[model samples]
Target: MILAEELTKILSSDQVTQNLTILQQHSQDESFHEPHLPDVVVFPKSSNDVSRILSFANEHRIPVVPFGAGSGLEGHAIPVQGGITLDFALMNRILEIYPSDFCVKVQPGVTRLQLNKELKKYGLFFSVDPGADATLGGMAATNASGTTAVRYGIMRDQVRDLEVVLADGRTIHTGGQAVKSSSGYHLNGLFTGSEGTLGVFTELTLKVYGIPECVMAARAAFPTVKQALNTATSILTAGIPIAKMELVDSRSILQMNRFQETDYPVMPTLFLEFHGNDNGLEQETAFTRLIAEEQACVDFIYESDSKERKKLWKARHHLSYAFRHGSPGKHIEGTDVCVPLSCLADSIEHARKKMEEADIDGAVIGHIGDGNYHTLLVIDPDDPNDRKKAHEINKAIVEFALQHGGTCTGEHGVGLGKIRYQRTEHGNALDVMMDLKRLLDPNHILNPGKLFPMSSPSTLNIN
Candidate 1:
């Protein structure tokens, strides 16, 4: 019997499906990368099932791609080589929640939104919101961070421990429930953004936070991108406790206005939020307004209304989708580059120039507080020139960021999209990563065509 047939023995008939529709859904992410359906999709209900599946794949050298929400933009979940795709949806569950310790242990398939809804009952929440209701395991796989990362930190920071199933079917928990540790290896950090090249996540122990006593949201409009960056940098420099600082360029604002039906000003804008004690939040908002105005803010508006606050963030989170909807059949490819705070303006300026020169049509949205931004590139699949231009613009952006002591990807992990830039970004460290990959997964049964440049195919199978 083949691997899929063997999987049926481990899981129930309903759990192991060779259905083409399911395979196709698990094949790709929300990226422009070409999709390839897996030979079969298996839904594992628990960690032992995951271990059994991995052991079988390791023995047969069949590529095992872990499928989460399929919301990733870097094509991290794509089953490049035909094999079994492991869908963790059935495993979605909150195993435990310790409000006093401010931590939660959850299964791999639980999503950020779902967990947050559960956390809300206890006045707690998982702060990393990547816009998508992405699975916590998938978020950890990418080390995802978003607007609130400015305060609560990235997925890597929130992760306290992980239960991972290895290629040979051995299961290991990386960290403990303790607030901090000086353990043997910081394995949690290693696997948080390893993109599943190392192993599959079965369970995750993550940190959570109580909802702030006071919360306020604002929108600061600027005449230019430089002005907006200056205000954002000034806010960071002054050490204001801004929970979220998102930079939305004029083009993106227009896209949002069109798609979201909101009459936001067509200018470079910062969507900011402050979290603290009631009086302290008021003071911080006043200080932030002063800095924004001093830095050429056209207008600054603040609101404590929860519904209005949600509306503002809703528009910010839906930016990529707005751009995609704006460009009907065109494929959307984005560039994720993060740099030092001091070099952010220069990098954004360089990106603006490149986009204008290449005539690549895309919208700009970023988390300015953390120096990570993305130029959501819209590419025409049929037009070779359009694809070339988009790719060239992406390369230029990556090269500039690397030269400026920045990374090729900020929040998005190195998957099929940014694999080529890994060697250039990490240099000699790339070799070490490859060695680790070999040590952990000798047969390369996990995410075989991702992360490492050598593993990814060069030709574009853009269909």
Candidate 2:
């Protein structure tokens, strides 16, 4: 019997599949990276199922790639070796809720929107929103952060514990129910962003937050990118405690206007939010308005009503799709680089100039509050020149980020796309990382050809 038949012996027949359509769906993520099909797909209903699947694959030397919602932007979900793809859809369940402790335990497949909808009853919500309704498991894998990261922190901060199934099928819990610990190893931090190369996360205990008593959203348009950046930095310098600070350039605003059918000013803009009690928010917005005005803010619009506030954020979240709608017959090559606040303006300006020099149609958008930004480049996949220009621009941006004290990838994990820069970004630490990977997965049956670039197509030799 083949791998699918063997897996059926371990799992229910309905849980094991080699269907062409399912394989095609599991082949890639939401990225421009080339797709490759998995040989078989298996859905695990419990930790025991995951353990059995890993034990079998490890012994037989078959590659196993853990897959969640496949919403990743960096090709992290592709099963390059064509072995088994472990789909977590069947394992999605919010196992526990401790409202007083501000923690929730969940299976790996639960999506952000699904969890938030359920959390609404207790006036609690998970804060690490990566815009997409991405599975919490996938977000944990990528260490995802979004607009609210400046206030609530990244997925790494939200994780309290992880129940991981090792390559040899040994089950381990990286952490526990306690809020803080001076424990050994800090395994939770290590495994949270391992990108499936270390082990498979079967269960996650994440930190949640109570809904803020008062919230407000504002939009400030600036005459130039520098002015907008200056205003944002000023707010942070002054310690205004803003919940979310997002930057959208003129080109992005134009696209958002056309796609969302809203009349936002066609200029560089900052989407700002404040979360606190009414008295505190009143003071914060007042001080923030003062800073924006001093920096030559062209227009400042406030949305106090909850409905209008939600609508404002909705437009910002759908920006990637808006770019797609604005540019047909083209794919978006999103560049993720983050720099220190002091260098953010220069980095962004450099990215914009590179795009202009290449004559590429794209937009600059980001979570400016925390200095993570994206240069969305629209390129015709069929045109070699377009692809080359996009790659060159991305390289320039990454080089600039690395030259400064910034990361090649801020929120997006180093999958197939960012592996080339791993050496430059992490240096000797990359060697240490590879050593750990080999130590945990001696046979390299975990996700291969990712995070660490392959020396050859058929082997996992990193040196």
Could you tell me every candidate's TM-score relative to the true structure? 0.96, 0.97
Question: Per-residue lDDT of 1-463 in model 2, one digit per residue for the tens?
Answer: 3778788899999998888999999999988889999888999999999999999888787888999999899999999888889999998999999999999999999999999999989999999888788899989999999889988999999999999999999999999889999979899999998899889999999999999999999999999988999999899899887889999999899999999999999999999999889988888898999999999998998877899999998888888789888888889888699999888888988999999999998988879988899988999999999999999999999999999999998999898889999999999999999899889988888898899964312332111
Candidate 2: stretches off by over 4 Å: 454-463
Cα deviation of 342, candidate 1, in Å: 1.1
Model 1 / residue 84 / CA error / Å: 1.0
C-alpha local distance difference test of each model: 0.88, 0.90
Model 1 lDDT tens row, 165-266: 998999999998999999698999999999988999999999999899999999999998888998888888899999999998898899999999989889
- For model 1, the superposed segments whose C-alpha errors exceed 4 Å read 453-463
Report each candidate's C-alpha RMSD, comma-separated, in the order given. 3.1, 2.5
Return the TM-score for candidate 2, rounded to 2 decimals.
0.97
- Ten-residue segment with the worst summed lDDT in candidate 1? 454-463
